[model samples]
Target: YRVGKAPVPPRTSVPFDPAIFDATSSTFYSALSNVDFRIGAGNAGAVAVRFRVAQHGYLRHVDFHIGSGLAGVYQAGNEFENLRFFGGRYGIMSEKTSPAWQFTLIDSEFQGQRNAAIREHEVDLTLVNVAIRDTPVGIEIDRGYSDSLWGKDVRFENVSRAGVIVSAENSVFTQIGFDNAVASNTPTFVRFRDSGKTVAGAGPRYRVSDFSYGLKLAGLGTIGDYATDIQMAPLARMPARRTPAIRAMPPVRDWANAHDLGVKGDDTTDDTAALQRAIDTHRVLYLPVGRYRVTDTIKLRPDSVLISLHPSLTHLYLPDETPAYMGVGGPKALLQSAKGGNAVVSGLGLWTGGVNPRATALLWKAGEASMVNDVKIQGGGGTLLTKGSPIGFGDPRARFDGQHPSIWVTDGGGGTFAAIWSPNTLASAGFHVSNTKTPGHVYELSAEHHYRAEIVLDNVENWEFLAPQTEQEVRDGVDAIST
Candidate 1:
């Protein structure tokens, strides 16, 4: 052992190939989930201490050694969901060098952190439905002004220190919910303690109860003279499940062209029967570049993977006709995937041949790791979806004799929707999550231009809507406000 100074150990580098991993296409990959990583026993130079998660990507559904003990992130856009961190020195620490803005965390839990659950600096954060248990400090935010700490359903129980520790780093708090948190000895929401890193920002704005309930409710400790907001109820009210219902890896079957399978992509033929037959028998729907017309609905097989040569090359044209509102599921969607379906529809184009405002472009009922990506849509109802469903246009649920949304989530099996653009859609709500008993997670959501409310939450207790980018609020709709 050295007596004068401690010697630094050598750093090992892990190998990663972008072409092999292909992380840019989120829907094509599933290998990152359900992985477990363990390092040596707790030591200063343990393998876990030297390891760090890749900067600006997803740490989803994997249990790492020290709970993604990430530091020195190179860029932004990193996401974490459904990950559990235990027995780690700290869950995730953003030091002075980390410049990632608005790192999103959803449906994750942290326990047995040696010091704190999170040690943040200079980064704005969005934490939804996250639980922190048995931690000294749940979260220690160093800066306050430019950094906004927005969270919903964030619970803290069996904590040693406060749920969050701050140094007046000047981070602003718009949506703060610590009314349900109990931590350390005092059980405070935000403890104005010293984290040693001071930041300069604005005078932080806060909104707790909107002229309804009084501030400083009983059992909830004081936030500080500068504190004044409360949070929504029931964040961790349910369990988060990440199991894919169809329990099979993305198939590696040989591609089969739809035109070769007795189905023509010509603009006039009613290819509904032929396409449905193809979707039922085949595992992959690799259509060539052409417009395939269909009069009736197409039922997608549970394990089918419908991918196209290119979105511009392949198209599904549904003609406007009499209402085919089948009460069995909801609407006879142009493309329907039933319960427990692990369908994958990607790189295609959908167009309602006529002004058929009665049916959705796609009704994805089975969201168990199912995905619909890179599909351009025009006209018709937008979409009626669960956790992992996508959208096109219009509200198919309106003609079903009930108010329906472009995004409807009823299942609790939790999934994700990314790069979703719903510019033109006729629906009661742009986003709706209801009729579920378990907590769900949907991150990187961007939707707009729908009727009624842009955001709607009813009967659903805890759903993590992380990094939502919503715009184009309608006149009658309340964007981002749950009613």
Candidate 2:
């Protein structure tokens, strides 16, 4: 008998029949054909496909099984091997598949395995634009004045700490004004350091417009540390113009013809009393360019006269033969008045032809209200002659016997003398004031002197010896003399 052929089984289960299944089901079968036959399509959807693997091991076939849905419906056998899978790995086939029975391996193990190897990827992107604004704050530029770009004016605040070096070639702060009515107690400008240190580099070159009053560097820091470094031209180029409220005082004439009395130019008559008479008239007494011999001490009373030396080339000589001819005695001569009086003596050269140790060129008695401006007291010959008595009219024994000074004020009260030039050796004190309740109120002494009484020297040049009394000495003297 011929070997009997086993009857051929049906192509596939009912759900997986190629003739009955649409292209979706056909494609799904084709994609899963490589799976083992032991895993049936009945449980295809029930099996789980893990994307993440455990440590030290690749995925094993045993961990994979048929999932539910269409994967579970079809059994895995020879009949299913010829089938195709598409769409979700093994569920359905897409209509887009070709007529050559082509199928998509989408959602399949091979497709996922191919894509899993890729890691780094690239993509394109874009960007956009944006902007911002700012406002200035208010700050004080000087005392009683503040600046704000938004509110008042543009001004830099305390720039000393900002480490900014500001330099203006020709630029300036124009129309900068301030109010003087602000209480004097309030600082006009704060000084970071000592006086004159803040603006030390340049002379007064900077000019402020609309601020007629002078601009003073109010601080004592290095010039570089100033908020601004200004190189100012002369005032003639750009005259300062300020509102009347803050305008500077008018210019004062050094000599006016309206209030002057003429005097002889020869060293013959004692013009001291005559000059004093003219001074008492509240007018200037003019000493023509000549020597006017002084005989007796001439005192200047309060509100009496302002003796003005003519600007012409003339000299008023204090003859060597005479004693102290002009003794400015009275409280007015010392520029001191219990009722607040003022006097000024200006533009005269007070010279003593004799170098008498006893002869003082100008004798200032106690309690005088006087100021000597632009006056020169020179020792003519350098011979120490004894003629005029010591300054204080008290006993001559009371005077210090050492080199008597060219200008001496004794039995003093508060007084002032300014703008005086004395180039002579003072045997005792160049300028002395003693024996008063409040003696030695002199300020701004400029001269070459051996000893200087209590005085504040401002802008003074070439002082050989300035023996200003110490604070303790001043206090002790005040106490001693007041008693």
Candidate 3:
């Protein structure tokens, strides 16, 4: 695989031969993307396609389904993008537990799921730029809410029972919304089964249109618009994704491993010198699952790649009693980004050891050509800081109002700090996006438990934010990432 660049394989549709196509059990962070799997009405299995245990993954441009049983996708949290499932018994039957803790479907299609296009329960659900058609029930929130649900710009066609179903037996939802929905052939847009007391005044910012054959639901009132009120693409049509041409990839053994270089990740030993030695020796680094305690910063080589597939499993921390790297407030991070620029760091967790309020968690000055995605930061004053436009002064040269990218942009000299697809991070502030002159890019921020604002924006413009959710929580008694 190429370093610092994401793999954009050729867009091909192939039959789902479980032996050859399914890589579900290959690796923890394996990406099954860039293809389509069609099941045209043949009896498949109870489950057609699902990555069983992917905590931080992004599955893009892949279609999978079964003719019988549950024929939809079972993914949550920054999982699906540009996906489609048609000619199946059901659309999406997902829960809150496996794969991830949240259900996020962006820019996808669900067709002919005669029963329910989406059967959601437990986790926080996010649906943006989605289309559901030819289904009896479109989006069925049949179960209780373990978290929140936020959606926008969903197109529906030929939906019979309702565009959405919110069960009354479910407990009170903390947050729920489905704004600006466009539908066709859908009667009774949002039907509240049983009583309506659970979601009556829940402040749901949802509306199902098509203006109805006559009227709308009970206590929730007349939902949606005239369906034709907004202009949108036809139902069940997923836009084609443009990507770079496919290239040959080398095997994994060529890269360097920190574990092989005599660095122990027991969290008790100060792995500073050995870690520094590993960094000095290798150009590409891989740290396996384990927590490594460091007392000093380990510098990085130029244009290197550091990967830890499981962020929740691999951690790098600083000891609580370790002396501050420098002066006032300990302005250093445990794992410092390389001044070398053009680095790729993904799938790792970094936390300031102990509950040191003045401790700084992370500092990203890896130049503009660098990227840090799927990395979790916890327990510090400055949880994360992306210092410049692309490691320099703001270059308001272009706007970022472009298509959603599954991976971090490599060629452009812009700073990208993506933390785990759509996972709800608990911090003092959700997003402290500031001091940039870049424009025309879109972001999907799903952060919660902020001391101040879910999104604290300052000195930026022309960017887009989609289906954002914010709440308040404090981690480790220290309010990190305060805007």
Off by over 4 Å in 2: 1-262, 268-270, 281-283, 309-316, 323-341, 365-369, 380-403, 439-441, 449-483
Pairing residues by index, what is the TM-score of model 3?
0.54
Cα lDDT listed for each candidate: 0.51, 0.29, 0.51
Model 1 residue runs over 4 Å out of place are: 1-144, 148-171, 174-270, 287-292, 308-330, 345-354, 367-404, 408-419, 432-440, 457-464, 472-483
Q: By TM-score, rank the candidates, best first.
A: 3, 1, 2
Stronger candidate by lDDT (2 vs 3): 3
Lowest summed lDDT across 10 adjacent residues in model 2 is found at 123-132
**Candidate 1 lDDT by residue in tens digits, 385-445:** 2111222224353332132354555554234443233333454455566666554555544
Question: In terms of TM-score, which candidate is strongest?
Answer: 3
Q: 310-375 in candidate 3: lDDT tens per residue?
A: 665677766544566433452455565554366667677665543222334444445554556566
Ranking by lDDT: 3, 1, 2
The clash count for each model shown is 18, 52, 16
Q: Weakest 10 consecutive residues, lDDT, candidate 1?
A: 205-214
Query: How do the residues 108-177 of candidate 2 rate in per-residue lDDT, one tens digit apiece?
Result: 1111111111111010000000000010111112222211101011112112221111112112321122
Worst 10 residues of 3 by lDDT: 398-407
lDDT of 3: 0.51
